[model samples]
Target chain A: MERETILSVRDLDVKFSLRGRKLNALRGVSLDLYKGESLAIVGESGSGKSVFVKTFMGLLDANGWIDGGSITYKGEDLTKYTTEKQWLGIRGKEIAMVLQDPMTSLNPLKTIGAQIIEAIELHQNLHGEAARKEMLSVLTDVGITEPERRAKQYPHEFSGGMRQRVVIAIAVACRPQVLICDEPTTALDVTIQAQILHLIRDLKEKYNLTTVYITHDLGVVANVADRIAVMYAGDIVEIGLCEEVFYEPKHPYTWALLSSLPQLGVKGEPLYSIHGTPPNLFYEVKGDAFAPRNPQALKIDFVKRPPYFDVSPTHKARTWLLDPRAPKIDPPEAVRKLATEGVKGYA
Target chain B: MPENENREVLLSVRDMSVCFGKGKRIFKAVNNVSFDIFKGETFGLVGESGSGKTTIGRAIIRINPTTSGDVIFKGQKINGKISKELDRRVTREIQMIFQDPMASLNERAKVDYIVSEGLYSGERISEEERKRRVEKALQEVGLLPEFASRFPHEFSGGQRQRIGVARALIMQPDFIIADEPISALDVSIRAQVLNLLSELQKERGLTYLFISHDLSVMRFICDRIAVIHKGVLVELAETEKLFAHPLHPYTRALLSAIPLPDPVREKNKVLEVYDPTQHDYSVDKPSWVEIEEGHMVWGNEKELNRYRDMLKA
Candidate 1:
């Protein structure tokens, strides 16, 4: 398959100024988001997964700034676009973001119709009736029944699932080329989550928009993502196709996350939990940030950082254990079943 | 789980209903829900957000006021039947672990004082004994003794959740209502907290009314599960039985919706949507019926017969 790269991010370094100290939120993060494909960034909280995606939209906090690297979108360097006015031209029309909480994302006071129509008007040249027409169709497009009635209603009148639909409608109003969902279904129930993921996938195909999902739920990532990137301590530890990451995962952090899944354990048995929490991003990370908690950490892992080792043409992982001289280790027993299932295409 | 006749029922909620507002604006959050938490077993209550799972958990611990129906603790009808004086002393045996550890724990108060708050209200104890109990609770939750001097704000989200667990364990309560304990935690930390809860149950013989929306987590921890939808009991059975043979449409829909960790399986999976309108309950009001020997499901005549056939097939 010939892959079309919609967005190329190279050695992106994002830092935040904290009380006179500099905290690097995203460190040398690099990846390509193929057109019309969903790439999920899976990691724990504060792993810089959100920061890595937020750079694409220029939505970083006031104290934060892009320390280095380039975000090339349609031949434009987004990192160099300093002014909010410059961002206005490409923000919603070219790139849109779907946040986790719909309550904050959607306007509570305004009618759903008014919010969607306003977004449509901002990006498109559609007038009163045309904009309103587009807004209602978008609401319907996102799988909300009775688009006319739903548009007239406020956010409180809608259920949690319906509210998320409204948020999606607003994001896709102008039909952006790229849709970055930051934990879009984390707020929704399991059943509603499936509904929303299906809707997003359908819309992604319809619009030919590239999808980037930032989430902690591995289940959601597996269901929605085409490619997977494992982020830890602001570093992209692993990146590959969804099957490649899940079936033949290389990083120890990925193994730890997979083994920690409660479903992997039997009744009355202890779960495989990682030893410690993520290191504080306040201080500069020395060597591998995951070494202190990683069970298979080598002596050199504490002294020097590990570079990316190619597992396959599509898959790559960063770990000292992947080095040629390092001792071979298999993924834990709890996770080996998952790999086999992925290989066989079913359990 | 042991035999129904052999095992003791720690807490039994009969027709427990929790209503919000009144008159024209009235809404029944939990409608005539009934279940039993057996001794030394994890009793899981699962449903979507508005399904009133949290409301039922609150009612059991007496945090939420009950409008009607009876909540029988041991052999006594405790809900709305007990006087204020008896309520405090009797309800002390029931403790609760909240979803958000940050919001539940006091930011200003030290860990030791926050944990001993329940003890301060209960039977009087010596200051030295109180210190010993607090230390023991912290240690049991896998925190160091020095952490007792620190405040809630000083700890991370996962560590603060451990503090919340420690606070509940300090009471040495018979039953604990774990309301979405692991849902608010990170994926990497969820297993550790879940294991701690399981250990506490085994070590202390504590019965847990584990309330969560995550089905897989429920399957791993709970011995028995009750599926609730729109404030109504849909199905109640043993964990393995319920997962394998989901009699209710809502339960089946929920099961199908959960995206498994395996990618190929997830990609091939198809979810069936459950619509309540498809069910015609006009002829007969849906009531809890024993579909099999132990599995119970709420349905009218049409659904009841269909569920039995589905179970067989």
Candidate 2:
């Protein structure tokens, strides 16, 4: 069956201006977010994973603007949305975002019930008793117990995990077709993180909502992602099915990321680390942005950017090594072990 | 298992307890926690938030006052009251690496001053000596000497964490208490910091007390792991033994919560939720028992016997 793309981004370019300097945060990025499928965007900090998704909902800062390209969602170009009024028509009713920190995202003074009710009344078009009923139902849906009593409590009265659940409740109250979770579990504990991931997955199944996860932790990505997109220096270096990306990765950056995990690492030995930092976005990037950090970079990689080469119908990578003339380089030992042994090697 | 008698006990916390407030609102942050950190070994203390893992780390560093019990370092008692010479020695020998790189560092101070801050407390050293030491420390952590002139705000999260490590390393301490050192770092950068820590340990024979909520990370780095819940330890065992045969229910739950980077296993995995109320310790009065060669568990007689059976199976 051919899957329908709910949101299609074609060659999107997002730029930010800081102190008279221009930063190419998202450079020629393209992605197709499928319906009811969870796509995880995995990258290091400053890799523009957040910037790429921010353009989807028109949430970029005042200093930032779309440089070029199109974000076509249901036949509408979101890049053309210049005013807050235009964005309001698409923001919560069409798409909603759960930000990284739950503490800062919520209002301290407002009751948790009032916040969810506000989102419910404004977006869902239900008011008074109906909105209040919906707020309680949403609270229960997020696994919060004693919804009636807890809803009246302030944000300071809740724990970190409970506050996150309230935040999730508010986001889901809008009944959006798509939900974007930007490092939702980064500030949470491991147990709480697992519960939240399960909750999100359950919510996705219940609502048939397309979910997009932005995280640096591959462990979290593996648990929830149906498909994975590896971003590097504001570019999608690799995109594939979760199994394909984990087992048969073709990009050096992906290999390094998988190899560096402590689960795959052998004790008393140094894990494969990507030396140096990510490339600065202020200067114009030539060729591959990851070329400087990549040890086995082909000469051509430094001169020109490699186009996406299809490995399989579902897998593609942007690297010169995938080209026909490039030399066949073996992946790191750890990544290769993962390919052959699967999870058992780590287990 | 090797004999622990011959091994040197670098720092030992005997029946230590830390309490906050008083008169109807007393809260025991660390309740009668006892453990010995051997020389040149990574001892992991794993727990969820509000479990007193940070409290224990603070108590050892003298940031928090211990309500009772002794914190013996080498041969002398370091906690509570001590001689001025002994206090100075303890300060010079023990150091700490904090969790959040962004919050731990002083925003206005240069890397040079931050790294050499410990040296400024004790003796009046020459400016050139302090500068040389700062450069050497930065170089040790794989940062360029020129980075010492820059402020903390100019660096990345990973770079800022390396500065934290450099600050701890400049003290030349025998022991370092790293409280969630890599929790705030990126995944790739975590590998860098972990490798750097192990490398430094091998080079200088430094002991570490690694505290974190993540069990998978503890599995990679720690020699022995202790599971604490609500300020009370439930289990202590070798890393492999803990993974192979987790006795306590809380330990099993914690291990089950670790998110593996394998989709097949992770998706099919069943989460074990721990309920502390399951333990009927009111009558039995649970006590710490060494169930195996080096493994320990906090349980009464009945629970201990069942744990033994679980190990056998």
DockQ of all candidates, in order? 0.65, 0.66
CAPRI docking class of candidate 1 = medium
- My TM-score estimates for the predictions, one after another, are 0.97, 0.98
- Across A1-347, the per-residue lDDT of candidate 1 in tens digits comes to 67888899999999999999999898898888888888999998899998888888888999999999999988999999988998887788998999999888888899999999999999987979999889878887888888888788999998888899889998999779989899999999999999999999999988888888999988899899989999999999999999999888888899998888876776789888898879888888888889999878889889998899999888999988889999888888877977664422111
Q: What are the per-residue Cα lDDT tens digits for candidate 2 across B14-91?
A: 889999999899999888888888899999999988999999999998999999999999978999988899888888
How large is the C-alpha RMSD of every model relative to the true structure? 1.8, 1.4
* Candidate 1: pairs in clash: none
Off by over 4 Å in 1: A341-347, B83-85
Cα lDDT computed for each candidate against the true fold: 0.88, 0.91
